[model samples]
Target chain A: MTEGSSVPQRCWQIDSSRKGAEIIRITDADGKSLIRVKPGVSAVIISSASFLEVILEEGARLELLRPFLLDQTLEREVSLSVHQAKDSSLTAFMVTKGSISFKDNVSVVLAGEGAEVSLNGLHDLSNACEAHSLTLIDHVAPSTKSDQLYKSVVRDRGHSFFHGKIMVRREAQLTNAYQLNKNLILSPEGRVDTKPQLEIFADDVKCSHGAAIGQLDDDQLFYFQTRGIGREEAARMLVKGFVKDVLLKINDPLLRAEAGGML
Target chain B: MLNIKDLYASVEGNQILKGLNLSVKAGQVHAIMGPNGSGKSTLSKVITGHPQYVADSGLVDFEINGQMVNILGMEPDQRAREGIFLAFQYPVELPGVPTSEFLRASYNSVCRHHGLEQMDPIDFDGFIREKMKVLEMDDKYIDRAVNVDFSGGEKKRNEILQMAVLNPRLAVLDETDSGLDVDSMKIVAHGVNLLRSKRNAMIVITHYQRLLNYIKPDIVHVLYQGRIIKTGGPELALKVEDQGYDWLIKS
Candidate 1:
């Protein structure tokens, strides 16, 4: 067993040589670890994902990378049950480029006070391909906070699906949580389904969720064209701006640049 | 500098501009006065090559260096490249597009077409700042969305701002002075007059003659029954303002 309160593990990117990859590890209290997986790679987490019943040495970080169309998939199941830990953060980037699908299920128990979780997911799907993303975040402890924001843009006949759920238990008081999903449909046939749901049982909690799915604004497109930009180029720029908010939040620069190129 | 001869157009099979003709020379401002349904808006859309308005037959030409080139076949963007600018009556509200970016693109397109060097970001920002001063617009408008959530007066000022940046050879102001207060009208006219060079021309389209009070036109054409039936000097505008377009129904 690895026993250390302030030890740093070198960041690791999943070895893509294998057809599939799996990782199962537990992070002890006051421990820090970094993991990055590249394209054509798969990652699964079976242990506690963040600071919960297990104390996450302050500033524990996790990075997941999913490159463009790779005939590969990403499946993650993480649970955080921190009771009294303070200042523990989890940052993950699940980038789906080209034709890729990702399924993420995350649950956080905030028996502890002053714990925070931030999840940012971005899917860059273009051409006549499809990309799917599903994320679930749960709040079971009081005085805990969580935020989830996912954005996607579909060009051509590209299709994308996003389903985000936020639940606040009766004991989770002073819980500040928000979930937002926004998608832009570029073509007439391009499709996207976004459902953002919130289940609140605590009487003194602040939680809100919103979902918006629409095509490019016609007036904006005409405004650009009248200024000398053709229809195709204007459409491309609008789509790029839609996905930028998600890409900018990713902690990894190389992954952000690669995601921008895929679009 | 501009001429439209025997123009016929319609929207969704409903004829609007039926055999219309007009001409404007350099160093002159011409006001087109007409009723609401008398095809005034249709003429503006047809001249700018709006896709919705189908032109069955007509010829629009812009004289460059004493050479008349037909522009009916050109698209709206193409017409803009050939020095034709239309200040829309109801400016479109583009929510996501930044005002500065749109202006720079338009300014650079025209300059590139005329074989002029493209203005860098610093120069472009300065150019717009100076022009906004003429319209009394604030500096914050530079980053706002194009006409998005702007008041009536602000939208009109934005149109003039675009006109000042583009500096086209022939400017077609379609009801630029409508829906503006007396103060905003004066500011819009001041901007228009400032851009009135000897080598450029203007065609101001409006229902009332109030706009003519600010930017006095050299000629005024009374459009009735989809055609220009009467032509006179600036006094013609006052006559219609007092008498109204009801007289055209009889003539």
Candidate 2:
């Protein structure tokens, strides 16, 4: 556990060498935290449980980056919960690669007025791996906003499932929410299931959700071939282009490049 | 130099070009005027080996460095590498691929086909900037995605810019001047005129004589129902502009 009045400039990195479950808490006012979990961190999780809980004080901010690398024989499960106070903000980026089976559940609560949240994620799965990601965002106060975008690319026999739920209580008036999920299937056996749900009880709220599943555009591929580009190279370029929008959300250039290469 | 003899083509079980024959010599510009659905665009697609257009029967040959090769069996990319270029009437937009990177990839592919050395990034940037000047294009377009969110005139200009960089032996312009203002038309024609040389041939397809007024054509052919019905000097374009395709169709 780490408690402090202020946050350091650098992100708090989890020890990849450690094993078993761990928990961290932050409750100080104006406290900030940046959590980064690099690839292969699941190898140290010998136990079946691993969880992270973050509590943000008023006007505080939290940023999280979880880039997962595939481990063939490992199955990992992780749960994350975030509670935002008045005028606080939370931004998160989650990217995952291969795993035999991986499950992640994320919950966010905008408990105070003027709270905002933005969440973006990408999953690149290949082989016989599977990934399930579930997100729940709750608006309990007035004048709250939330935006979410998630994309997945499945290849070979890989499968991915994404379920996002946004709920606005009766007292949460003047709420604004948007959610979008997109998937690209590369092979015939690749599969993706996405569901975006929004339940708003406030009369003055605005909410929209969208989901799309598709393959590479054949016409665009042929257009590239006309310019003397080989089919394989053209396909690679198109895949990168499809995910470029989500990757752009990452502010770090080096990390963005690494994410681009994974595709 | 290119030659097509008794070409027949179809798309999705519907015949478009039936026994079409035409010839274009080096150092000459040929204008093909026709009404809508006269198979003017089909000719260009057949020549470039578009996947959708199937050439049922034809002899399409091109002279490349003194070697006459039959291009009917080659792929679109192969024909492109062999010095055949087509400026599409509607250029496709690639949302996330930068124009500079796309152009570099294309240029290097052609270079590799010809056993030429590839240009480095800095050298390629300088080279593309020089070519962009010919089309009067702004410097910002190179950094943006290929044709993404480009205006009509800008898309046409970008097509010409690509032609200037590729420098193909046989160039086909399929309604390149369909939608353009006076200024943009002049810029596009100027770019085309600058690239014309004695070693290259051009086949310009259009429905109106507006583009011909800028880039003068040596020979004018009236195409109707997939065949060249009439061939004459540049004066023929004036006749079609004065009258309409109704007279030619009736004749």
The candidate that achieves the highest lDDT relative to the unseen native structure: 2
In model 2, which runs have C-alpha deviations exceeding 4 angstroms? A1-50
Report fnat in order of the candidates. 0.29, 0.59
Worst 10 residues of 1 chain A by lDDT: A75-84
Q: Write the per-residue lDDT of candidate 2 for residues A1-263, one digit (tens) a residue.
A: 23663453334454455442332323221223444433323211111123555556666554555656666487777666777778877766677888477887888888989988888878888898788889999999999999999988888998989999999999999999989999989999999989888888988998999999999777677678778887888877877777788888765555566556665
Which ranges in model 1 have alpha carbons more than 4 Å from their true place? Answer: A1-121, A143-147, A204-206, A240-263, B64-66
Error of 1 at A57 (Å): 6.2
Q: Which digits, one per residue and each the tens of the lDDT, describe model 2 over residues B1-251?
A: 79999999998888988899999999999999998988999999899888889999989999877978789999888888888898999898998889998999989999999999999989999999999988999999999999998999999999898888899888999999988998999999999999899999999999899999998999999999888888999889999999877787887
Candidate 2 residue pairs that clash: A70-A98
Task: Evaluate candidate 1 and give its CAPRI docking class based on DockQ.
Answer: acceptable
TM-score of each: 0.78, 0.88
In order of the candidates, what TM-score does chain B achieve? Answer: 0.97, 0.98
**lDDT, residue B179, candidate 2:** 88
Using Cα atoms, each model's DockQ against the true complex is 0.35, 0.68
RMSD in Å for all candidates: 7.9, 6.7
* lDDT of model 1 at position A56: 36
